[model samples]
Target: MAWWKLHKRDKPGSPTGAGGAVLASAAIITRDQVRSVVGKGQEWQAQAWDFYRTVSELKSGVRWAANGCSRARLYIGRVDPDGSSSPTPVDAQAEDLSPDLVARLLAPLEELAGGQLGQSEMLRRFSVHLDIPGESYLVGFDDPTSGDRRWLVCSPSEVTSAGGGGTIRVQLPESQSARVELSLDDCTLIRLWRPDDEYAYLPDSPLNGLQDPLRELRGLTSHVLATVDSRLAGAGMGVMSDDVVPASPQQTDGANPVHSDPVTAALIEAMAASLRDRDSASALVPLLLRVPGSVKDKFEWHSFATELDSNLLPLREAAIKRLAIGLDMPPEVLTGLADTNHWNAWIISDDSIKLHLEPKLGLIAEALTDRYFRPAWEALGVPDPEAWACWYDTSDLKQRPNRAPEAAEAHARGAISDAAYLRELGFSAEDMPDEDEQRRRLLIQLATTNPQLAPAALEALGVRLPNIGQGAATDAVRAPVEISRVAPAVEAPARNEPPALPIAASAVLDDGWRMACLDLAARRALARAGNWLLSRSGRSRRGELAHVPVHEVHMHLSPDQADLAQMLDGAYRDFHAATPGETDLHAAVDLYVRRLLLTGIAHERGLLAGHLAAAGCDRAAA
Candidate 1:
């Protein structure tokens, strides 16, 4: 038999430490049998029964006993209630390890084996889980009976498997060491034992929230980081010491210095630098999307596209995965390589005989559209057909002297549209509308009318027209179209009414000064006309006149000099009087011819008339 007793150090009235057998006296007995002295079924008596019942299930009594009861010893340390002396520790005589105790200990385990309850099921009913902090980690558990339901907090890293059922190791809250193992063979048993409270921690569990869909990008980030580390290592510091540079120091010194291989920091800086050309930087997106490991943190593609001008190229898994899993960009947007026309021109238009153009890789979708796709349209081959008429207005194709004449003819022949041509120059048709088309047409018309316009006009159109005179052509191709002889002017039917004083011819003329007002009026008008052609479609302006209206067409006059009309007028009479046979047409004659042409142009511009009487012809006659 077991006994309970207090040691000599225990306080008065405390039972002897080994008097465990008698410790289960009236105080320990159930109140149901104590109604004679105590009151009938009270709340306190009910609570006592519940506690005893719970304890009884966890223990088993031993029947065979050999000796008399041995008292249990207890030790109680003195306590200083006012902190006058010291605090005391308390200990009590422990009860016997009876059969009821054994039964209680195995109660959950037996229930688990019998398919009554599960071993380790998630407790999802409570607001908060209780975590006992240890040296390095925290262990969490469900609080039973405190709230409406129970909860069990487990490790997120732990994997729960249902084999021959599962196993849950229940731990005691007071001691970090306490535990009880239970095996549940039936799924129903585990389900029934599940708690109702919700238990969650920071960074929410996968079930609590969707895990980062871009987690796979972490691999790419790691690769990039590794590459960056190697690059940085290779770029040696000014001073070489014995030990390695501290990583923290490297991180703190944020600006990345350029080195042999591009580090991630340098690459990122490069990307940022590209953003300065906001338009072109968009091209980097496709390339960047392929960079693994948290690439999402590096750039926001949509915002970047909207903010910067660039091109993009989809290279590997990183970019493709994000396309499928995260972003909603369209397929055309993603693969928007430059149009065929521009690409072909860029690659073949050059005179290198073997063209080499290499674009950066891993660009984003938007950047790809802007940088690679748009510019590539011309070289890639024109996409549309109707834009050729005004192609010179918005593109720079016709000025390529090195380009094959066939290509220039192709442009002039409406084989390619302005939009297609610009697309070849890496421009997008999405934003450019029909209004732009009309504007482009007007500008081209203006440029074509100006004979004095620079070759840059054709360059803007993407094709340079080679100046091939009849002498340059093969003899077999000297074929000429029959021209009608100068016929007398035919009279037109007179209008019944005179035309209204047509909104002042000045309205059609770009220059405001009239011929009567200034001697330079004609020259000024000519210059104004040249200026008008040059300004039209080279760049864009949004306000004021949306388009220009024309009243009369004044074709440009060709001459080597700027004031060709004045030069030509000065040489006209002399050149006309020179006797065709008598004059020795030597090198000086060629020079005189050039001067005559120049003077005629200047005369037309109201400058000076040509004095073409072959040099000393007039003086010789005198």
Candidate 2:
């Protein structure tokens, strides 16, 4: 019989030897038969019920894996004719297809998976495709002018493959009686089965390998719950057994026999009622029964107690560990074990992403590239539609161990630029300071150290310099004048009147002031020589110092000697040019004495020529 004719009558209680029975008996079933059995018929309904129940039961681990795997970032890319692939530009366009430009283009496909379906829900549904045969979604575009050209992603339960498996028919959600037929070219189908010849149509799942562990986990959990319930059932209830003997009959007067007295019986009944009320009100409290002294010895009391074995803890842990092993995740991640340190946690996370998530993400990327992106591109009249593809950015999915120290060392060793170092530390261009800003900061540092370059640096950076006159005015306003005003002015003493000095100068008198002039010149020459030596030695290594020429030292000192002479001449002129009222005699004498002391020290230490000669010895040896 024809496949279509078989599907029309394929019901649970259909006539034997008819179309339905013939199709069921056949070993090789067509797509129409598979769909009729697994899509909309009683079998489909039963499978759907089982599918949902399994999902609900495995909600914790299943959701964890699905959400974690799908949280990866998605992006579009294109393959070059030379076989290289690069991410497509965010603003890329191709005729009427601007996939990146229109945010809503795939919104329905990602979020509107019929009714309240969204990207996460869609991912979860796709993740379960392995549990079922496959996943199917009906695709439809919204109005282009409305800027809502999103494809509708309907549930797979509503879709059924046609006879040849090349097309599908969707039973509308609004009215299950109405059906819309579409070719496979217009739908997005993700099969979890192998594409090879063998087992091509059979569904496969990672969870299949975890069945034994999952069963053990369920059994252990049920045992624990049952144990707890049993303990609770008997908690605080006093012993009640028929093994105890009854109390011996008590002797009493005829009028006061225990069973015959109404007042005594009434009092006993009231006390029993009160005890029952108290026991019921507080279940934790144990009820006590009192007997006559004579009868107490004849009766025995017992206690009912329940204690759960502590060995069950290890069993529970073992079950959980088995589950984690099956899932290929860290035991701590699923069981909340807190013994792991940061380093171990990081290693586990990295391993989980590499082993579990990467393969799944690769499959998803391939599916999106082949089934969705390629078709969309082709519809837009794009040239070489096979060149374009979609991918996920899994770079941020795993936690990278701290590498700041290594990157800093590399930067210090000049192995990487500042930008490259930043990138290694997971920073983008936007996170780093711009070249202009860095340059401005460098200029500011240079100006701070040199002072001479302050104006030029400030001008280059468009920074206005403070006016010199304004600074002078502010300083003058803050100057101290109260001390000078409070003290009386003292006139200079006579020069020959035995000048009162802080330190007595050498009493050696000269017929001319030639000695004083020579002393001043000597001090100035020593100062000039020290400054010249320091400047000439600029960054010279100890080994290189021996290679310097003696002539260079002599040449270096000549210009400094000339400068010293000019400074000495200027000082002499300033001293001689000063008016008597402007200069104090004691101040002039003190300055001459200090210069004399500096000259004596220089002559005694032989710093006048010996210092330069010693430095030039290295050069002389060379």
Candidate 3:
């Protein structure tokens, strides 16, 4: 005996199984028993199974619909505490945890849905809740040996709700045929459904509600498929009927005559075989049908082909539209029939996202927030878990045909802030400048353009400046005064005092004296012009010419002083054209004055020295 035949056969009812036959029989009996148990709730369960099977058959289309509906981003936000029901930015800690939690949830979902799945897959799996009454999942460790847990979305068939929806029993076939019964409170599951009054145990799915339309769609699709097969099979090909040739050419005898001679028949067979053998590598090869020479002129080949009508297209499209209506999805999305114009496309996309996708996303988001986010945040010690909620940010996903121009107009009209406008344009918070920073920049710009307003701006900002003088001086001084005064004052006579010198004596100045006085005035004006040039140079060198005030060097100069002032201004500008760094304007003016005074003194000294030298030379000659 072989080793395989050594074991003894066990009885049917016995637990012990030594033979493979007993094990095989037990497996068969167990499957049959499971089926028998499942068959007890025949009517509703059978309908549910039918829907599941139909969805499976249309898996690609169903998946596409689900994905199109789920292509929106979800974010965590804080619920307003004042009962406004408005969302606010999440608290710092919750905001920090949101991305990690989102990533953690997404990673496993992608793994479960295969790595190609994204936010769309997460919502698609949750969409099963829309197809079935509800879905239950086992939230357990990803690795049974490890403590880390994840949600495994299971089929409705795998879970059996019992005790009038109090406790649910889950049978894990992969885990030693384990059966676990859990109370509603203990079960960690998310249920997504549309509310209605019809069913008591579970809500009705879109699948159930739209069953008739779906059936019609299925029938239409079958008809289209059949039509395509028929066209491919025979409609496009020409068939030579027995009566296609004139009756005069056919034999009148009751006995059937051969349709064609051996060579023609062989050619016809070859053509038919070529057409039928579609899988053959040479199916596309050109074929030639030859007729015998004696009968060729007498016979004519008459070909007939069934006409393919365009009428079915509209009917099939109408059926698809009905199916789309039933699914609560846009027809364009499901059928891939789109409007050519950008405006129409945008309108359709916007309507679908707002009217269809958002509501569905909201259901999923609420469920996940309650079942997944709350517990996770609580575990991480986040505060006020009740106030925190998850929501979909469909703003980015929505098509905005007029957003650019609208945002620009709103910004120009001061209807929205710069940051808000940028956000509408899809800029993130981190990418925009803060309001306070923007205000500060604006103030700086205003001050640069109008330096006289700098003091007022600083005062508004609550800056305190040192008092120039006490009460009297504060009243007297109305503007900022320069530290150095370049212009000489011509003081008026006191009220009661007489002129310093007799009016006649003051007027009786010599021509030489008047010329000398005019010369001094000219030098003074030149010095002032030099000072203005130096100030300009300083401002330019500091790279703050826009910020610096323009000094009017010729302000106090008389009409007679204009020529020398303009000449000196031009000369000074030309001299310092290439000079770098800030020039000391006051210093430049003082240096010019000292040089002018010293030049006169030097001339007088030179005259004295020349006279002394002449006297010494005379003494030496004597």
Each prediction's TM-score versus the true structure: 0.15, 0.48, 0.44
- Report, for every candidate in turn, its global Cα lDDT versus the true structure: 0.27, 0.45, 0.46
Ordering by TM-score = 2, 3, 1
lDDT of candidate model 3 versus the reference = 0.46
Clashes of 1: 174
Predicted structure 1: lDDT: 0.27
lDDT of 1 at 312: 18
Cα misplacement distance, residue 477 of candidate 3 (Å): 21
lDDT of 2 at 320: 64
lDDT of 2 at 196: 22
Model 1 lowest lDDT segment of ten:
61-70
**Order of the predicted models by lDDT, top scorer first:** 3, 2, 1
Q: After superposition, how far is residue 575 of candidate 3 from its true place, in Å?
A: 28
Q: Residue-wise lDDT of candidate 3 within 369-479, one digit each (tens)?
A: 654555455544455666677666666567575576667767867998878788778787788777887877777654543435766766666667677544433211234
> What stretches of model 1 exceed 4 Å from their correct place?
1-415, 429-516, 531-600, 604-622
Measured by lDDT, the strongest candidate is 3
